[model samples]
Target: MMTIRRRKTRKRRSPQKKRSRRRRSTKRGSQVKRRRRQAMTHRKKRRVKRRKKEIQTRRKRTLKEKVKLLVINLKMILLLKLKKELRVPQKTRQLQKNQPQKSQQLKNLPLLSQLPKNLPLKQTRFQQQKLRPTKSKPLFLLAKPRPQHRLQPQ
Candidate 1:
């Protein structure tokens, strides 16, 4: 069964109510701005923290690699020193046997000095000296033997 009832009629709001609503809406705009500012600050802080962590990790990796290279260089220097120390006695013993022959050659030096010199060609006088051996050694092999002939790694 359907019962028919008379509907309640709408009443018009007062001017004060409309004014209060406008006031609340204006206040809400400022509140929205404050919330957005807080969110922006939080995001910036998080990004800065992330960047710091990445930089620290990079520094650690670089430090580890540097330590490894330093260790390798030290090992190479130690090995070179050990090899030179062991080989020195053997070389001195060999030089003992060659002394007589070297003295004979030294005696013949006077006769060789009497030979006529070749005339210089189109090149400069000092230019041919570049092909001669040098006494300098590399910085890394400072503890190596004197007059290093050839320290080829076996």
Candidate 2:
């Protein structure tokens, strides 16, 4: 007769797994280790969140800088085109000399610059009195609010 041997499966007592960094003194120590691992994971998550925010702000600033550079390039090109159009300043200045100057027109009529003292000047006391209203009563609008008619059910 052949003897059939039964195999009993048992948990391994040796600490070799990734989560085996614990002393076998008490359960509280194990809980402390778990809490530490949780805190480390949370800290890493917060750091990742901060890094994402920094990346977003950097992207926005880069976009704004790109727009500013494009605007500057456009302004430079337009300035170059304008410089080419106004290549000769001397001829334009000579043409402008032909037009009558505003100061030259005013120079012919000297009477307009200085006024004669014969014009009537208001007295300062009367002018000051007219500026302020002496009436204590409040002035109101002439228009009065019309009475509203009652809505009738036809």
lDDT tens digits, residues 24-86, model 1? 545787889999999999999999999999999999999999999999999999999999888
For model 2, state the Cα shift of residue 15 in Å: 15
- True-structure RMSD for candidate 2: 19.6
lDDT of residue 92 for candidate 2: 85
Off by over 4 Å in 2: 1-26, 88-154
lDDT of each: 0.68, 0.67
Per-residue lDDT of model 2, residues 17-107, tens digit only: 6367656676897799999999999999999999999999999999999999999999999999899778958888788789789678546
- Among all windows of 10 consecutive residues in model 2, the one with the lowest summed lDDT is 137-146
